[model samples]
Target: MGAVIRYTTDGSDPTESSIRYTGTVSVSAATTLKAKAFKSGWTPSQTATAAYTMSISDTILFSPASGEYHSEQDVVLSCAVPDAIIRYTADGTEPVESSSPYTKPVHISETATLKAKAFKSGWSPSQTATSAYTMSISDTILFSPASGEYYSEQNVSLSCNTVGVTIRYTTDGKTEPTINSMTYTAPIAVSETTLIKAKAFRSGWNSGTVAEGNYKLRLPDCITFSPEPGTHFSNQKVVLSCSIPGTKLYYTLDKSEPDKKSIPYTEAISVSETALIRAKAFRKGWSPSPAAIGSYEMAIPQDCIRFMPAPGTYTEAPTVEVSCECGIPDVVIRYIINDSGSEDTLYSSPILLSESATVKARAFKEGWTFSNISQGTYMLKVKEPVILPGSNTSVTQQEVQISSETPGSAIYYTTDGSEPAENASLYDKPFSVSQTSIVKAKAFKIGWETSGAVSEKYTIKAAKPVFSLESGIYTGLRTVAVSCETPGAKIHYTTDGSIPSKASPCYDSETLVSLSKTTTLSAKAFKENCEPSEETEAVYRLKITTPQISSDAGGFSCETAEIRMLCEFPDAEIFYTTDGKMPTESSSVYDEPFLATGYVTVIAVAYKPGWEPSDAAVKHIAVKGDINGDCSADMSDVIAGLQILTGTDSAPIRSDYDYSEADLNGDGRVGSAEIVYLLMAISKK
Candidate 1:
């Protein structure tokens, strides 16, 4: 750059009409400046060019790094400069000054190139930035036995295309998780028309796309009984048939586990007593055929069924017997374990169950009605006691730990001064506590009374209050919120810079902090039976001030006048009004000289924000004569008005008063009527 460079504003070759380079040349919009170096009649140098652009918005920056994305994205476009307007377009094109301004955030619904720019007055337009967003699916799901009708209850398995992703499936047709819809880990049982929707999830990545299908299961191959499965006459020979082929049928006489060792069906046995028949088939490499059941009452007298030992919790399997009318000869008993209904085991002798079970049985004999069904529920014994860290009352301790002395016990806790529950928020790790917290814990085993609720108390110290807004300079009215980490702490605050106490304006539920004038807000947090937090403060300074002009602005007689404006605040802008409306920040800014033609009133105000606005400065100027613009009216002007009225002079009335303050009537012309009106007005004065 040269010190004596001549620049052309009209985009032409630089000549004597070019301006001498002094400091910086500001433009309200985009411009190209062509300059040539020249010194004392020396040969002019080659043309140098510079371009500038001033827009309403600044350049934009995006979050979450741009890439091919499969799902909706809340793309936030932001600029570094305050008060800068942002504009954007998804369609690639040059943006103008009046483009769409950035509001909250840009939502990219599909693949597109997002172009944005920032603009503000007095600054060169920023370079445009672009982010290309493309739709993508991180993973797809594959459902085995994909949605459709089936002959029976079907086992369904689902898999995700991508590794390291967790799949969640929903059978309730709702997007949110429920008791029935759960995270997928193994095969699921489907017995009805279920719309199974699944989505894949991985940390730090957008949730994968959702895939859904419907499934239905029906049972058609049920067992067929030759003699209907109801009350039957003693000595009735009933035949059982299975619909599935190549199936090995098995049956049980004593209510016990039926395996290959159980009795095999070679011939139909004559029924002398009541018998409840249950059977199932098995084939290699296939799920065991569906178990079939039938109940038949023989036409004979029988007694109620009974268990040998009482039904209660036991350390080991109990040798339980299904006994019925002991003197009845050749009576048969049948029972089902755990209500599984999987098999009708014949209870011919004492049976020992290894696990918990609810057993139901009946006895039948030839020519006898079936005995009344009897049921019993037995539970295994409690394993051991859980010994977890229990009571604590330290001011610094934030959490209490829990563990089980027995390997299989689970711990539960509560903190809201309420009784602990097994389904409360799980205390898997240490949690922060800032106030008096009553924590109750309990250990649970499969068969044990949960260890007496282990009660604990944590006495916490006071924590400092945090402000939603940091202390800084603001332009307008602002609202701030106060928050305490302590659960039950009360916030007290002041605006006069006084130390806050219990008597100060206490914030019980209110969180809003409204600020209009420059102030320092101080606050403290207090809680009963606990500590009070340290006093903290924040300062907010107001920045807008009223504007001032060069003069007090009263009546003035002149052909034309120019006014200058000023403000005390840094970077404050001045706006003015000719027509009497309140001056706002959006009013016309004081940038260039204004021509006051004829009689006029000028009102101006100063504004920024965060500061008090300055009072309006009004200036009034009046020009009475001098139509020729020599600053005075005499015989020549009288001659001109008459000449024009008499058709002697062809000059228009507007030529003298268009840009000069000479028209006394405030009209747009200096014609005969205006001249007569001016003479009469001045005569009265």
Candidate 2:
């Protein structure tokens, strides 16, 4: 048996609105049940049950944990209790089962809070669950000590605008820094121009955008030149540049100082003559550096010209021509025809050489040195007739008398078939020829052409002897070679510096000429039926040793140089020049080393009476603002200057420096202003 149950639908207790217990009590609608057991009433089971309300389910849990997110996400509500309706709201309001039943997942696309709840017919309202879906956007990074120039040294710091993000950077701005780059842990030292790049990175989130910051902190660098100073070249352009890239360079060419407002250097400037170019650098934020001076020295070379027909003696008239070569387009050729006349005539055409004349030509251009002289001489046929003795004629008499009909004529004869020059022996008196011989004669007269040479045979003759080596100085031991024009003629030579005779050492083998003091050698020829040949001589002057040049180990100053020259040979002469020219025998001989007085190159050579000139020794010296004579003006010099000013112990004084090296203003004395100048020179303008 089962007990019956009764219940009331009103809100009342069991006495007011009673419900009896039955086999089972199920409520499909809103009702309150107060039950008690009856019929068997056994002292009324103490109201076997008091009240029955309703059953409720738990609230739902949303998937995808609540957090700030960057992308879109789905909002799903779930409940552990079965057969419960879950509802969600994206408008950040309270959620109910009937508001919007979450049959499917709710899409959350923007930044909003999702509120969810669960409900059933026999259950109370479930707990509300809310999830906030905030769309996270990466923030742009920030840089401190922003991109600009810094006068002095500075430190640069990097920061991320977004919280909880790290920044990475690198000194090499040319590359992009990734997460593997140097992690920025401390501030960077910006002593020079630098570029800093950084980016923000975080796990489970997109990396922040890359940011860059450039900081320039440096002194104005030195300016540069294309063709450096101390250049004496020509026909070129010069380019001015600065050590700092992209810096504006201004220059002046009119021998004036340069400033920022002067002509800006674009490309290169053409230098035609000597110019003192002064230049300076200019930038927006940097200080104007000291002027960099570049003075260009150039020399225009003269044109080269020459005679068309080489200068030589001619027997007949010929065409005289002049040719010239010059690099400049505007050029002219000036010429003249006299032997001792100015070349003032401009060359127009070729001239005919009808008589003996001298032609001198030279090329010239405006603002250029005149070219080297070009000279040539032309000679015509002689007017005199042939000599009385014809060529290859036979003379029977033992002595033949030859004469020229021309006025003031004189005859010279050679025993061998050789031409008679003006220096040949004069035949003033006729002599007897005891043996057969060959005679060659010529007639010469003042202000008249020479007669034709005549050669006659008197059955036999001998040729003259010729020396292989010319009559000049010879160093060391020399082997003299001698030969005659005729094959069988015996060659004779003398080493005692006297005229040779037929009895002198006959040419049978080699002859060696040793050097002692100045030694002269003479040689001649002799044959059976011919007169003795003319004597040939050579002077031998053997050398002892080369000359030596010496100076102070510290070398010379900018204004003066004292050098000494000495030769091992006692009689050797030393020649020197301070202009860098080679010292020839004709150059100025030095008695003692002298002051150079300016920036110059010193070259010296030594020559003995018969020995060759010694190899030239050269040295070059110059200076800038080297006040302490230490080859450079630097901070050490500044310290020295301060010591000199303060009268420190063991310090060099101002008078110790030379007038040219220490005198800042060329006032012939060293002063505090000079020390100041030296201090300014420390930076090397």
Candidate 3:
């Protein structure tokens, strides 16, 4: 028997040849078959290929041919032949006809392995293919400084592992993963809170869900100070903390970032002066936290106290108060009075006064003279009163007097008379008084009753006259004038040097008495009710035989010459001189009138010696040129002038020529025509 091959073709087959059979075939109705046989060493045999209908089973399978995908990544699986049908199941099961057919690429949701097969009618099930598709997780989450860590400004790299996957990320958690990601490089300063996420993707693959991370951005550790910024401090410290949790604290007072070796905060610290402080809190993969601000001031003790006093003056005993309040509570108060004189303490107590003497006060403490003698006062006392009365009756013009009833008893009297006492009467000499009347006086004794002063209204008189001139030898040629004065008395006087009697020449007032011979003058006065004062005399020492000249008969011009003779002393004989010599009896006397021509010297001498001589006197003369006696010279003088026509040089005009005789033309000056007329007149005479 030969085996029979039975196959059905509905355009779904593995091989390209048509279905073939051999030998006999039994077939159901509605089936069509064609057959062929193969025999060895002989011609092929043909058999009856019957047309019979038979049922064939069809299977479906689905798979991801490109398997093992990251989450939400695309995958593809194919059927065995073009006529085969494909289906898929996400539950990792064989696909049935009811499942959706794999008409396009499939996507893997998670890590998965899938089986897929092809199916055709009247064909054996295709060999099952196992495909491993894995949904990869985006395990590489880019974390800056981690969430609970403190970090300073630093760089961090972010990455992920997934084949054919493009990554997208967000730091603020506001964006999803995509091919275009808002990415950043390393060295992100963690100055604030930040969130990080990433996703993976490729073509024909869905983007993976974003993986998230939390971190806190932090700044560098910094130290701050109150009241002063940008300053350094020594032994300074600050509180160390972080913006994130579970971070270690570290600090340095220098200007360096804090490290593990830096000092950690446990308690408060004392800062002496300026210094820098830095601190940082850190954890794994996180930036360090910033430092805290710090400031401090130390307490100091006071040094010393000082005081000063204002300036002032002291006239009498004076006290000034000063105070010092400073550093310490208790202080020593030391003072010196009159440091220039003595540095001894005047008073340690509160009261310090300038005594009756000049003094300066100073304050000293702790090697310092805080208060100086910038001002002071000198004390002066009033002098005692000096009593000046020396007599009880009338005080001398400037003298005062006091009287005592008993010896050694004091007398007191006030010129003002304000009081009377025993202690007031030590009079010194040489006092002055203005009044001419008496002053009040009283006498007092300690045990005896005070005696009343004999009050007499005694008058003060003017000083007596003292004679200044005395009897003396006499000069013979000069007259003497005498004078005398008695201040309050009228004086009477005589020239005989006799004691002045009531009948002597009385001078009711000051007078000058002239005398020519030796004589005596006596002066006296009577003060009120006092004795007549003695006489005062000044002798008249007169000069004898004094010469004199006649002031009226001295000289005139020759035209009007009229000579006169008179004595200087009408009571004495006189003489004269013509040749400018002293005169004697033989000298010519002026018995006649004469004419003069030019200046001539004439001297007159008194007949007695010891008298003054007259100074040599000169007379100027001129010719009378007017020949007419009409007191004028006009045409009427020509008839009289022609009568004396002589040629004599001594001719006179009408023999009685005067200044009018020379005035021929009625003019005063003399000329030659007047002289000719005078010569003619002289010739006529």
Candidate 4:
């Protein structure tokens, strides 16, 4: 029979496959064993035994393979069974099963310790295998916020233990965590009523339950008022109010709380003076609202008045009327007489006076006063009566005289019917009237009767002079003998336009005068101290006549070959010829007077410069020929003899040029032609 095998080693329970021996195994002196067995059927039924030391490997073991645990979680203890049955104690004790089979791995709520051992069937338990399994509760399934609860849309943080664990959360106050793959770091935003939940999960570990948190949604605090700021009011009717969402509002005016019956606005509030007001509002879950302040300054009513008066001279009566202006009610007026230092009350009445004075008027109210005075003197005098002119009508071509009744009094007059005064010119003499004239006059003087006036109407007959001028011929000098037909009068004349005076040159008896050319002769006649006659019509006439020729017989010079025939008329034309013959219309006309020349036979004729020649006067001019007369003799007598011989220089020779008397020869040409007579006279001698 085989030995019944029941063995244990290394403080472990023996098993069927544990190393078994049938013979007595040898036991060395060491604490180790060689093969030792107990056999019932071997070798004649001899009972042999051997002793050997058993060996064990050093190892540690655990009970469950893998599982989950919160922080501080304790678990049961166990070890690998081989050579011994094990007993364990977690509280630092030796192995013993009576310590209650490690009651389901002591549910450690926080981090805890674990220890275990193995015992053979008959050997004392080996050294206890010890271990400390910490129930490391991870930061898994981090709630949105770590500690305090918060409102919706409030920021929160979520965290996890595993590296890639997806966390989801909801704010709707539900236990279900929302499925959102977000890393648990920063706070999450939430809005409505919410249940903040978080879960941590990886691919291998079991998914976690929802970690729950609750929150309520709320709105931001606000406060508002009606009838907004900066509003104007004519009559103060103002409404004030305030409101805010999600909260009740409390208000105060002048730092007093408002009630239901309290007035929030004022109507018909009169502001006579400035005012300072303040108001405020408040609400919960928000900061306090600022106070509303206002200030106002009222305006005053405007009223003013102005007055003016005309300017005038002293001693002249000037009337001034008063005008009133009142902007508000209950305005009264009072005046002070500046001339007499007296005050007078005027209730819509004019103040009249009888002397020169300055008047000052003042407007008054219950609280105000205005003093305005006239700038000029107001004079009072008796009204003066006006005088009327005596004559109102006039006549033509006659003299009408209007005179003032008193001398040295100014007579005001006008033809246009306007106002007049003593400053106007005084009337003295009658006006010599021509056309029909209307005249008015007034006489004025101080301290005299103002109404005693005189006027009259008169007519006079027209007297005129008519005549003709008997114009005489001009001799190249300005002179005329004029005659008129007006009877019983003396004639006055003027060459220029000047007033005819007694000293003016007069036209006397028939005078031989010189004149230039055509001219107008003007003249008038008047009886002494009588009205002058009208001027006669102008006489437009031309004068044509010859001037007398004269010479100085004693002033003749021997070198002077020709004699000059001088005339008094500067404008006359003098014509001359060499032959001793009278000039006719066919003779050469002289543009200018003849100049004295040597031995020239000049037949000089005097006439107007442009008119036909007058009768010529023959002159026998010779160089110093007038020994007794001191005058020259010209070729007139010489050419006369030459004409007697030639028979053409002059048809009828004068006795002065006869060769029988002058030639001394039987031949012509005077003395030269009679040389034979002289020689014969000598020969006879």
Candidate 5:
């Protein structure tokens, strides 16, 4: 279209000095080309310009292009634009902006599909790039006889899914297998506990996961026992066991080693008394475990027998009892009395011992030995008779009584001083005795020996003599009569204070006792075949009457007063004293009336021979005009005398005039005589 054309390889406007365009401009890459048309003629037409850009393919590029791979691959995705972002999805899903952005290469280990896309800001997104990948890794290595426990040696083999794959292995659990590790050729021998690991390798395939296994091969465990090996009471149930499963246990009751022929332990075994037990364990295809020995000894407790009311003497018949300690069940207690060879009797109750005997007992059971013999010796005797109102005593008309401590026993007694025999009189009732006697008694029973003789002496004393008069003061003589209750009792008397005997005076029915003086009369009674009665006595006072005083006791107003003393007993002498002293036999004798001049106290006593003295009689005298009894005549007494004469103060004067103190003339009343005596007394003063 133009005569000549010029173009620029860069993105500049074309000029004349630019490269001239030839036929069909070819650019190795994208470029902006320009051309200018020119000729010698007038103005050239507008320059032509064109931009040349290479087209980028939307399909992704891959290195080592996707195909089958024996090993894992790292796949990369890219865009032609340097600043384009590449997002990828390896799970065969359509890629989006939210997919994982590709920064480094993506690793592929298994069969998978990878898709990718490129995006830029304000630019159209590139089409999804897709690729398919396949992986060929060695199949998991296999092991024969998977990990477990075994009792004996085992042959372990290693294999893989790929036929004839080269497999490297390691027996130690710590080291992992590599191609340089041990090579697997045949089966591996495993004796003790071990762990086996292996890995498979080929020229192009990758190695599989490390194959691992553990094998335990050893001997079976030994047998054991419950309640192992010791002495026990009663019985024991021996249980045998082994630690390993499906193992057989054998045991023997006797003290011998156990073998396959011994008793197989299926249930608990019973061991009674003293015995030993041994056990062992066994299994097939393995050596027998070590022997387990259990020595069990059984002991039985001893049963003891005892006797109640142990070996001792008893006063009366005793009941004996026999028993066993803690009382053995279903055991028989046998006993024999007095003789060892006698027939045995089963004891159910206490044994009655009426006589002396030796009791022997033993305990018997079915499976146990007889207990030791328990013997007791008992000597029995009758109790002696008791005599009522016991021995060596005196009594009057006694009735004797006898008894025995042993019931239902006959008692024999004798009145003489001899021992009682079985044929003597048997005491039936109380017997009366008026004379002294000695009682001897013994008790007798059927099977028991007679009791020892008991002697008691009873002195039957005669009744004491009694007097008709009692002992007291007497004014006249008395005749005493003595009497005795016994038939032939004799009475004796003594006037003196000595013990009365037969040599003393004998008393009759009538006897005179002198009462002129005080006397003590004693008497005693006696009889044949009886003891003498105790002495009895009577005392007679024969006291005289007390003397009488004829004068009044209060004040005497006269210058002199006449006092008289008299007694009822005509022969008694009355003695007196004027000074208020007690009158004895040596005092002044009272012959007639006496005179007292001043204040005087007359005390008198009457006495006679063989008689007790009489009590004293007293009289007091004072001056006639001394009305107040002051032992003198004065004006104060005169005024009292004048008061007694006048009737105006008669009440108070009469109270003070008791005992006729103001009766001066002894007329029993106060009058002009008392006033005249007081005036004469004042004149005399």
Candidate 6:
């Protein structure tokens, strides 16, 4: 017979010495349990073989922890228990067995809360698991061609990592970009230099930071050579220039390409020998121009017969003199106008050239070969136009007039810096110039060549000076400061109500002007190259001393209390009001002593024509000896006043009445004098 049973959780056979089997055997995982029945010395029964398996419910686990995310999320749900089914809800609701089963990863492109649970066929459902995700757009905007300098026009494109993001942009540098700005859909055409600011926005994501891209598009103009490269019989002066203002020119004389490291051309180049010149132009915020090649061929100088007054333009009729420079004796000089044959006139005196012509001349000696031919091209251009008021001058306004020395010459003008064309505005009469401007005028005639343009610049008035203090009433000594917004301006000021001029006192910015008495300040701003600014005036009225009341605020005993007012300034007029109203200029003037009766409040103020009014002075007067509240001075009131002073009274008096009636002399105290005054007031009553 079996008395006890021994068991082993391992798969080995159970022996007599194996552990005794308890009420229950705990198995964390699948195990084979063997048990045998045994008694004191009896042989152990055959081991009973049994396999056990365990299954424990586990909570659902999310692939990623709950937190904020910048992009879309692919969430995965799992469970520790094998073959357990996981269910989840994305709408912040509890997950049940009837909810959508978790088969694939859940897609979370926006902010949402996901709750899930794990369940099996024969196991209890795990605790509810919760996860929340907050999504936002963190991708920065990208601009094509980046933010850099460009020589030509650019087509800019905008992009973001997000697919459905909208980009707003602004070309103006003042306004910050918002969702309501210009939407970037297609490539933007940037023809000029500008600053582009942009921001990205999405439906359910936060807006991105502003991105700035600065694009510079400037193409420098090519260089131009004066007198054109050609063959000449005299030394030629080659000048390298550019159409754009403030552009620097670099050139090489050995027919090589020119760059920034080449020699800069500042003046005209004297080309005596045959050489090739190449030049390029450079300027800030602009691309370098292409190389300009000019080849100049030089020849011998034609100096045999020289023409006087040079071969240049002149407004008046010039007397051209032709002289022979041959070493031989008895040489003759002959000249001809425009392609005329050799049978021309012989030179005797200077010839007057009233029109444009090319003079060809030669020297001849009877025994020697004929001298080389000399040619001089004279242009006799039209007279230059004259501008009134001159150049580099300043005025408030000017009437601009243009005139030419030659009659019947038409004048063309332009305010901009461009050269005047034949179809430009014709200047027939004087025009009014009220603002700063640059005027260019040119004269043209049908017979003669057009004259060179005359340029003039005029500046308008300077900015008005600003005063730190406004025109109002002030007190005590005040320090005033003046300023001018126009740079390099000088400020002049006056304090005697007079207009300021150059001769007035100049105000230094580092120092402050002081004023002790009432003053009317005037200021003006002036500069060397600008007209003086308009006069600015400010009236500073000093305050007058407050009036003083002659009678004290205590009681006074008489038929009527005499009240007087005084001021420190003798010229100040004192005004008073007895109806408890504020005193003004229209109040009664205290020229002499005034009398007041009954209970009254006297307010007085002092005023002057060009000064601020003084603070009001107040005085309160009560009916004297009226301790019994009868509004009169009598024997019974005198007894009440004596009782108040002696500290033995049957009826207590009102504090306001007691204070006023006790002190009859208005000395701010009550004593024997009050008693005597009260007795005298009773006699008068």
Cα-lDDT of candidate 1 = 0.68
TM-score of each: 0.24, 0.27, 0.21, 0.24, 0.35, 0.31
Tens-place lDDT per residue, model 3, 1-685, is: 4533334423233121446643454542245554444434545444434445433333333433444444465666654355676656666787666667667777665556556566555444455555666555545554544455444443445565555455566666677656677654444454456666667665654455667766655544443333443433123443444455556767677677668788876654456554455656666654555556443432112222232223333223345553434332333444444465554554344444433323344334442224433223333221122234433322134554443324544555555444545565444343455444444556544433345554333344433344444456543433333333434555566767678766777654344555555666666665443345545666554433344332222121223333334544544444555454666657765443444333233455443333333333332123333344444334444444444444444433444334443455655544557656656655654
Question: What would the per-residue lDDT of candidate 2 be over residues 229-302, giving only the tens digit for each residue?
Answer: 75353455888776666578888887677786798888888877767888887766566767888877653243
Better model by lDDT, 1 or 3? 1
Off by over 4 Å in 5: 1-303, 306-333, 340-354, 365-368, 376-395, 403-408, 413-426, 435-442, 449-464, 476-479, 484-516, 522-537, 543-607, 612-685
The residue-by-residue lDDT of candidate 5 on 291-403, one tens digit each, is 67777754222445666677776667788888777344667788899885869899999998878788887877665445668788877778878988776545466788999
Clashing pairs in 2: 4-21, 4-22, 5-20, 5-21, 5-22, 6-19, 6-20, 7-19, 56-123
All candidates in order of TM-score, best leading: 5, 6, 2, 4, 1, 3
Q: Which ten residues in a row have the lowest lDDT in candidate 6?
A: 551-560
What's every prediction's RMSD, in angstroms? 44.2, 50.0, 40.1, 35.2, 30.8, 32.0
Please give the lDDT score at residue 493 for candidate 2. 80
In model 3, where do residues sit more than 4 Å from their true spots?
Answer: 1-443, 447-564, 582-602, 607-685
Q: Clash number for every model?
A: 39, 9, 53, 71, 8, 0
- Evaluated with lDDT, which candidate comes out highest? 6
Each model's lDDT:
0.68, 0.66, 0.48, 0.46, 0.75, 0.79
Tell me how far the alpha carbon of residue 562 in candidate 4 is from the true structure, in angstroms, after superposition: 38
Of 2 and 4, the candidate ahead on TM-score is 2
What TM-score quantifies how close candidate 4 is to the native fold?
0.24
lDDT of 2 at 545: 51
Instruction: Put the candidates in lDDT order, highest first.
Output: 6, 5, 1, 2, 3, 4
